[model samples]
Target: MNGTNKGGAAPGRGGGLASPRFAAVMASQALSLLGMEILQFVLPLHLLNLTGSGALYGGVIAAGFVPYTLLAPIGGVIADRTRKRGVMIAVDAVLAIAMAAYLFAAGTSAVIAATVAVLMLAFAAQALYQPCVQSAIPHLVESHEVERAVALVNQVGMLTGIGGPVAGGIAFGFLGLAPIVFISAACFAASALVVAALVHVPYEPPARTAGAVATARADLKEALAFLRSRPLMWRTIMAATLVNLFGSSFFNVCSPYIVTETLGLPNQLMGVLQGALAVGGLAGGAIVAAVPGTLGIRRVPALLLGVVAGIAAIACVLMVPLPALGTYTALVILYLPTMAVCMCMSIVATSYLQVESPGTLVGKVMALAIMLANCVTPAGQLAYGVALDIVPAWAIALVAASVTAAVAWWLARAER
Candidate 1:
């Protein structure tokens, strides 16, 4: 069955990103993820405006991460034990249903609660769905083409980042969240159908020698043991955790605060600023796809140095006397190179991990790595949220740049 049409074509036999099977996977992911990106952009801003509390905004956003972090490992276990296509289809369907219900409940007293709940469901689904897609990459393309395949998949997400935020901002500004919710539901439904009709992955029935919980425990133990043997795994995990803490968390909490509250900019501008990061990511993916041979894991530290500069520039611009629009423009411009470097480093490290891991354990191993790296993200978001209330945004940015510089220095030494 693994070699038959029932699953995807045999591993290493399919063409690179041009293969029809891999193309279907990309299309399916694109549909669902675009809807997700729109909602992710709109929901937090909507809540922030509604409540006018940065701390509350950060808390709600951070809450979604609870399920995301907890379910990631389980998602990996399920990815290994189940049909990958089925998992994708099911998760998309569930997301569609959840969003549809939220569509009906908008503007009601419960809308806020509904917003939080729907967001949690979306995050949880993403946790489960991503491992399936990530682990499926090696099986869908030639061994030599794995890095490009990874870049292509990443590019799909980045494309959505651009389109989703802009669309969401315009829609939320003019038409409001109801139409956006309706569109999101439709996208998820379409994604589920697409995956059902086209995408395929090699599947083998797991030998049921133990109960589900025991099997998951055993699988996690095995993954941990494998990770322990690879020092690269720990290094990558630590580096990623530091970036999430000092770099990404700061951006997430501060970006909306500065745009909507400090500058009093409209939702449309917020969308554009958010889309800048996506543009950077898309560009980075293009670079990786074009020149996979040059960027290696050892270069990850050097990339973070670019991020440090970006953050430092952001901090400096905030303190200078400038018009709100001028500051906004500067912030958007700085995010491009910062996020571009971040994405490149991420793709290189992930591709390296995928090539090194055994196929049987790839899903769990990747999930474990994701879980460990992201576990601190919620705390960072919360802390930044509080810091924004207590300290100036410029002060926070300066601190973030310094911490990132330290992490980059440590990563460079470790690589040497």
Candidate 2:
């Protein structure tokens, strides 16, 4: 169907606000995210239990992103040229099988090998599936509704983020890692089934010249050239890269360490902290959903950078000592909201990019941007690992906060 009707509302298969098929797709994605959140905690914890090496744990996380750098462009091409729904289903099935294999072989050398393989496949699937999902939204909804649609998706993800870790930790504590992996596999299978039942996305036509190598090269070049032409795109990408480097670096190791080391909190408390951040993210998503339609898209990127700056500054303050339980609780409360604001801004920027960019080029641009952001994460984790050896945890946190604030401001002003 054409994207719009004479009334300027988004046209769906039937006369409705949103296509049922599209809603089903969203539901599947939400479930998939929930499962992913569980695995996010379980995987690293398992690695630490097995090896106890910070560097090795960091490497395992880095390996997943490495394929995105190498294969995302290709994945984008496949998404555009093939049937997107089928591609998603195939990818999901493969991931589920791989995860199941890992579960069956838990704790062996084979388990690690299989786990890495499954993660790589999952990463590739994620790269392809994201663009397909984003591209599908415009087709299913009105242009004016794009922002709301994106916000809803982000909200679902955030909600899952809040629950996934808590559930994962419980499962790990009670059922062990094998059960966690099996459950994750089941979630992926469920997601695939939901997609199959609900979505009827149209199949893309095949390329006219089936084996046209030169045409593929041209597509890659054009996507890169388009990115280079937009200064704001480059600056936004740089901003996101730096933010991920400083902010998420600690996420890979610090939260677990903090719970176990500093506060002498239990694993359950660690789960709560991780889940609380997601609650903050959900609040941010709500704020984005509430924004008026008249504002310029350019404001999104700038506001997001500002929020990042605020987060860094607030983090610095939270690092200070408190004499009482009540004071520390107040500080934690304040820090959570700051994190939410930063996450909300970032989500808005992501939505703006998805809507503003051309459909054919969107996949490549997103892939490249994510790859750049993720590539540096390993380095950040490595830095944190080394710093933890010499510098105190609070000092490392302060340094990270300082660097993030500086980078955020630089990014805010860079394009303007």
RMSD of each: 3.4, 3.9
Best by TM-score: 1
Q: Give the Å shift of residue 82 in candidate 1.
A: 0.4
Q: Which lDDT tens digits does candidate 1 get at residues 1-416?
A: 01121233345565777888899999999999998998788888898888778787777778778788899999989988999999999999998888888877768888778888988899999999999999888788877788888899999999999999988888899998889888988999999999999998867787879999999999989888988898867888888988887789888888988899888899899999989999999999999999985898778888888889999999999988899999999999999988898889889888877777777788888899888888988988888888778888999999899999999899888867
Clashes of each: 0, 0
lDDT of 1 at 320: 88
User: Ten-residue segment with the worst summed lDDT in candidate 1?
Assistant: 1-10
List the candidate 1 regions with Cα displacement exceeding 4 Å. Answer: 1-11
Candidate 2 pairs with clashing backbones: none
Residue by residue across 252-277, what tens digits does model 2's lDDT show? 56556545445554556567677777
